[model samples]
Target chain A: MTTRSPLRIEPTTPPDESPPMRPSDPLPALPPPKPDPATVPDPVISARSLCVWYGSSMALKNVDIDIPRHKITALIGPSGCGKSTLLRCFNRMNDLIPGARMEGTIKFEGIELADPSIDAVALRRRVGMVFQKPNPFPKSIYQNVAWGARINGYKGDMDELVEKSLRRAALWEEVRGKLHKSGLDLSGGQQQRLCIARTLAVEPEIILMDEPCSALDPIATAKVEDLMDELKEDYTIVIVTHNMQQARRTSDMTACLMLDEAAVQGGHRTGVIAEFSPTEKLFTNPSDPRTEAYITGRIG
Target chain B: MNLPVPSGSVERPRWPAPSRFRRYQGPVMLSLLAICALVTVLTTIGIVAVLGLETIHFFRESHVSLPAFVFGTEVDPPKFGIFPLIWGTVMVAAGASLIALPIGLLSALYLSEYAPRRVRAVLKPALELLAGIPTIVYGFLALVLVTPLLKACFEPLGLKVDSYNALSACVVVGVMIIPMVSSLSEDVLSAVPRSLREAAYGLGATKFEVSTRIVLPAGLSGVAASFILAISRAVGETMAVVLAAGRMPNVTANPLRSVETMTAYIVAITGGDASYGTPKYLSLFAVGMTLFVMTLGLNILSGLILRRFREVYN
Candidate 1:
């Protein structure tokens, strides 16, 4: 809980210039895409008519979302609204849950993620995720950052990669002195940042965070929020949140999911997208009445 | 305001009183539980006392040399050495563990990490059934079936093995404890939280890497404990070793040679000879004491390994 603001004030670029990390930071690094008002930005990931089912009952139906590159996109709604489900879809992380199934197309870099020819392992190298709770591996903080990179055949200087990732997560100042210490020994906020650093060492193009600050105190939450804002300069982010203000404060665009009231097919209520717009428009002048009620705290 | 403040001084807080039965029944039940717990401790001490007293009597009353009795290989008349039996016990247990550890742990890994629900439901209980078979049945099988098979395999290769050989005992003992190791290891592996697996997979690790690096390491303490327990079981096994491994006091490391284990010596001596106060009768207690010490050491080692590597999950 020590003051964690100085790292944010500093620039995120590597201090001492070294040869670029090629294995992870894809060849010829694409500059972070600017969200220009005059032209439409290309979607880093585009899901078309996505439907998901857990066993027999449908969880989500015909949900479409275009997540812009190098910008924070927030998914917000009440519980059981399938916002987290949609976030996990970006990395095909839903495949891990038993009996959970998905249909329709989720395309990343113009390739369908669900295609059998595409390798999930290689796909995950470019699309990483941070979980709802801080889950740093039960290893030293140094190892926690180095493990993914090592397994992915990172041959460059691991020490430099570990330092740069920690700095990017805004966790370097507190933990650089104790890199060999267990990641589990950190406070809740630090642990979450360590998890983020673990994801960053792999050098993914997009990062998905599922309520990364829900377990943190207000001060720690602010620290992570600041880090997220800084992260958008390099990585495309998709975040799921119950906190509407967090969506407004951190994201460039926001998507709201709502449960279907009418009987879909089975007797169960299904979740679908109610609105998708720029964060400002979604908060202040939503086209959907439901989004306005949710923003104003009239209904959830 | 609709709410009214408390008037004057605050009264002493009222508390919910316990029912008469709730208040009075605790001591009675707790005493009953304490008695049950004390029974186990008392039983262990009673066994040790019986063995120790007889062992001390044997050492003192007999006109035998202590070093010769311990280190000698002869079993005729005055010198009754126990070293050969201890060596036999260690060799057989070690040989059996060599066979059991990898096969059992791999089966456990399959059940916990790779197998589907249908496969696990059928496989897990079938393994436990292997453990529940009577050891006497295993002894009968070893004597009748396994020894002949070993002789058939090795005799043509020019190794001589008796009808009752240590190889039969070690192999059968290994098979018997496969279920013991597999079942215990499966339980421990299953206790490893799924969140660790998810984290590894999210990092792009395959199922193999997740099971081996993440889940296996996290569950090390429990796996090590199961291994120690299995070794202890192998050390104390009696009936099968008696029927399969012959009653020869050969202390050699050759597994194909006929040998006698500590449990076998204890059982065979007491079955048909000498008065209660005789040196031969008292020898059984000395051997039993040695077996108890060996198992106790293993149990302590198991605890140490468990405390050192146990990964705490929040």
Candidate 2:
């Protein structure tokens, strides 16, 4: 019922018109602090100066981020801001697309993931993903969960593993009665949980979620966010979300990316990280004016 | 003063006014319904009347016993019967379907899953072109080209050669029906949601695993329907069999031996000069009726199979 206009920020003034703002602005005039390379936590996966191009168009520009271990990090941005594209880079899922090219170092577990020595199949097994929409194979619920383990050549006790994974996903009690039924027969929330169970069955060290709750109702979204909180005790999670509330609720760290109009080429566009910080600081007291504007619902 | 004046006001009608067009809606709808019912009944009656008359005339003039018409009789001129022709038709159809099913299904898999967009676009139309070629042309090709090629290929392998045999006819018929099977199976394969494939890939499964475990099983009913339809086409084919299957009404099951299907036998008998109201003349109708029954049975079987295992995705 209420329409709010976006807050527009003035660009940097030309040198001829006015002198540049002094080092002392109203906001705390601190220099960009660089974390000491030795003190910084060793990232399980890190991308340095990452850029992606589609044909002649650039989609990402010099994105540098480090994913800490055993924690949930959220990528929050407006639509078409390349959060999903950056999330997909962890396991090289972007390789499936045509005419997509990337220039960067994606180090997974201190090893360069994009190097020729790193097998894409093995990397995907180690880092699993759950999509925005609940996509269950047209199979029995049991088969849906067992498929990952089977493909990964797990020759262990599959029955126990399936049960354990389903229970971890908080879906075993509800779905155990109907394990033989088609996975597609479940409710939307149950299907998404089943997909999480399927991903967990493979025992991946890290999981990437691309707007996992965007297709679900509020209740389902709450359940998934709760699951993500529970999952972070064991697995590193990287989630892309447009819901700032969800990022505030579930993530320990948040990275906000915005499209960089200054970097656009011809008709092409690119996204750059506008801010990255602890969730509490980013939501309650963002340092950047643009970040403050976004968090306050003044601009998106 | 106003309230007192209102007591004497006349009442208006309770019903709303109807427009002229609204008043015509009921009668127009009823007339359309009547016309549709009439057309359906007339078509059904026309088919039953024509087939019923011809069948009765055929049975009356054939001089063949009813039991002998269904099974075979060892009478002097060998009374017309459906047992041998039905066996031949089933054998040819089954053999042809066996050959076409795997090839068509695999090719469909390639086109729908593996081929790039441009290659698929070109390949699909080329396969459909195979279906559009006239059956008469296939028959000619089977007679003049395929049979000789088969003979040449088989002579060195220590197999006897018949110029017109079930082997050549079935092979050619299978080739003729390839496009139907591939196109129908391709449609069913493509109808599977892309999310299913993505889910499999996300699980670290290879492309082959995804295709075999997910796509094929999902499309099984449609693929089975396509196979059944291809078999029905093969059974009902007359021109190819007539040209290549050598009109011998033998009850053998060997594909290498020359055989006559029900349709080919009917074609052979009808194409010959036999006086009207004679046993031989009536035999054509008997064979024609047998062919029709076989095809109808196949169609019903295919429909039942499709209904039984139809997959529902929501």
Candidate 3:
């Protein structure tokens, strides 16, 4: 009955919520304070001064972040703000994109990922990924979970491995009777869990998920969020999400990224980390004005 | 008035009334397109009618018997057994598949999974150019070039290689249909969702593994359909076999010997003078009918394969 233009910015500040911060305010020179060492786990993968580019356009600039061991770290931001790009950089997935180049160092368990001698295949075995959309191979349910282990030369009992992976993904109970059926025959939520099971079968220490629940219904999203909570006891996770509430509900650490308007050149704004802090503090008391604007839904 | 009337009370006139021509345009265009579609169907029916009538006339002749024409091996008084012709066709087609299937599949995999964009842009059209060349030119090439090369290479090994042989025809025909298999298979392989490839890559699979294990299996139905279609092309091919494999209708498996295929025999009979309603003229219809049945069967099989194994992605 009525048309509400998306571009119309009505800055409504609810009485209980903090006031909307203006974009003109200067950002802090230093990054947000890190959590106390006694309270947080040690860093497993660290990126310092990481910069990525697609041809002449800079996608990510001077990104510095540490992924703590056995904890869920969420990267939340607007579209084209390099959330997916940064997540892809963790496992060297960016190498697949033509003309995508990165400058700077990324260390995964004391090994420099960018070093020419480091085999991407071996690195990927230790760090698997689940995509934004569920992408189970056009295979049977059992084979979808076993294919990775088979290729990686796993000598263990395959039936046990498949069951273990499925159970870990919280999908074994639903799919136990139909392991021979086509993976595509599963519901959307079941398919996403199958993808997670497939990643788990590789025995990876860390899992990178790129908006894993964006294509799922609320029930599926909640299921995946719960699975992440359970998985963090053993596997470190770094998830990129457009849903800020999902980040708050599932993550221990949170990072907000936004386009650097001051650094805009030729109509392209490079992505930079606006704030990085504990999930609770980042939500309750954001240091950056842009982070507050994004968190309060006043601006993206 | 104390109260304002509701919006439903307003009766605004249209700026321009809908035209009758606009309403009729869809049905008129549809009828024209239906006529265009019926042309191919009519042509197919016409061919079947002609072939059936002539074949019936051939079988009705007093000298001809179904068993003798299909199974007997007599040479005197000219027994019309089609075994040798059918055997020649099968041999040539099978040999061509040996050479073409692997080469075409590998090239399709390279173009779809490994070749850079600029390389594919330049290479794909060049590969398709193989199909655009006239079949007669390939016939000439098989007759002169490939036969001489095969003879020169095999004679040194103390093996006899005929000047007009089935081997040369098979090689050239195989090369001729390479574009058909590779192009169609490449289109299918490329149609597979990028997410599937990314999923495999994220699971620590190598590029070769991803191409062979994931993409290949996903596109297998289309690739097989392409293979069947290429085989049909080989079976129906005429000029190349006639040129390189001379008119000797012996049913032998040796690739070095000269062989006459069913298509080659039809071309030989039709190109020469054969009066209408004569057994010789009527024989052409029988062979043509057989060829039509083979190709139609293959086309149907290809369509069924495509329908049965096609993957749906959301």
Candidate 4:
């Protein structure tokens, strides 16, 4: 076939659309209007000047954020930005990591969470977590759901508790047939749901998820997103995601993290929040240049 | 206008490569491995054959009636009863298990779950060093050091403890096998995925609860295997038992009394006490067979327990 005018180049942008330039187009010099703290409801958990160090080096620096109750807050960052580390601070999961140390105060439910007098185990009972990958215990489906409840001294009908938690996680119908079989026998998505059911069985008021859908298929990710939409009624959720689309799809509030370069903060390249706002405001009208560059796929 | 084609094609040999190295290596290597496998089977069959022949000769020539030899305890003219030896072996193994199971499992938990990295790095190799120490040293320690201490402790309780008693051997054997159980169980416990621990900790479980409930159950197969292997070592233990426990064939249930084990009896008879080819010498083979059977039984028990309770992960 003869080449016709060396392959015609057409505008990919549709006529009626804004041609994708509105987000990046230059406007009058204007700064993001900071939200008034008085108008916003009191946060369920608030971090003040939070800093974290690993051994002799810092990992996070001056991270201040408020997590609203019963609402989903998404933490988006590039790799090594310490989003997972911040999630761990909520229930003191960082204590398990050796040489990990934190500075500054974190208030949960208007009560300071970092006080030495607080028991981590008790705090964890009130705040649960799901990990990046599906981590179902090598146990029966029923036992996986019931273990957290039994350990937390749930005196209620355990059979009903397991059923209720599974239903809440939207896993009961899929796993109801094989309650006695090993949880490992299930697919990756089903196993993730089992972990969610296990966390729900503890009756935590808040849940921290570290990229919960990273290891899942798109269908499974959509299912989890749907589950989060329903779960916001009973549980405050904080999630760390590299997928910016996921933050917009599922979260009410969004925070973007970037590397703290040596140019401003000594020589260490720690992680710091570049911007935090409502998901719609953050995506449609980002406050920080770095966040816009990142969300637009310009930066790693 | 000619355009240059991209040279991405890989070079291929036409046929019958001049280099014959890779072609003949497979069967040659397979034959070498086959020989190695055959040697193991051959050695096992050879040992069984030798032991079996002598064991049968012992029964036939000794004429110490099988039922009587097994049941009767009289040994003046060599009644050849094995009750005392079996009892001694069982007691020492049972005692070793009692001591090693708790201490070894607990030490394993500390090493696997609680110890900091630097501490584990120093402690783990040191613990394995205990396993490297010769059993002969343990035997000497039991005879010289532990026996006296046990005697003194029992003296206060009005029990007459012999210089060569099963208690001393059992205690020393327990110490000897501690490393085996602890190290193997440590491996098992550490092999339990970090995700399980995170899940447990996320549920408000303390360190104690996480270690005991989640990690322990997850590592149950390896932990149970460690105990079985330790007990088998106790049963087959020769040098330590022979030194600490006297060679006297006294069938008694008391731990304070000196007792002979199958290994000790075999050693005593084979160490020139009985002439070669005699029924007494042949008895060594029979005792070896019994010890083999007992250890086999223990391994089978371990396999069954592992199969029943194993929560295998991908």
Candidate 2 DockQ, CA atoms: 0.43
C-alpha lDDT values of all predictions? 0.82, 0.79, 0.85, 0.84
DockQ of predictions, in order shown = 0.43, 0.43, 0.56, 0.64
| Model 3: per-residue Cα lDDT over A24-98, one tens digit each | 323223333344322444699888767777766778876778899999999998889999999988888988898
Instruction: Put down candidate 4 lDDT per residue, B40-113, tens digits, no spaces.
Output: 99999999898888778888888877676666676433677787777788888888778888889999999999
Compose the digit string of candidate 2's lDDT tens values, residues B44-69. 77866666677778778766777888
Positional deviation of residue A142's Cα in model 2 after best superposition, in angstroms: 1.4
lDDT at residue B302 of model 2 (Cα atoms)? 76
lDDT of 1 by residue, A1-300 (tens): 111111232254331222312122222322233232213269999886677777766677666678999999999988888988888778878887777767777899988975646778877889999988898878789989998898888999999999999999999999999998888999999999999999999999999999988999999999999999999999999999999989999999998887754323335656777778899988988867777778899878
Q: Which candidate is the best by lDDT?
A: 3
Candidate 4 chain A worst ten-residue window by lDDT:
A1-10
- Model 3 C-alpha lDDT per residue in residues B8-124, reported as the tens digit of each score: 556865445769998899999999999999999999999999999888887786277777766555322256777778778888888888888899999999999999999999989
Q: lDDT order of candidates, best first?
A: 3, 4, 1, 2
User: Which 10 consecutive positions of candidate 1 chain A have the poorest summed lDDT?
Assistant: A1-10
True contacts kept of each: 0.44, 0.50, 0.70, 0.82
**Which whole-number lDDT from 0 to 100 does residue B86 have in model 3?**
77
Error of model 2, residue B244, in angstroms: 1.9
lDDT, candidate 4, at A202:
92
Error of 2 at B254 (Å): 3.1
As for candidate 2, its clashing pairs are none
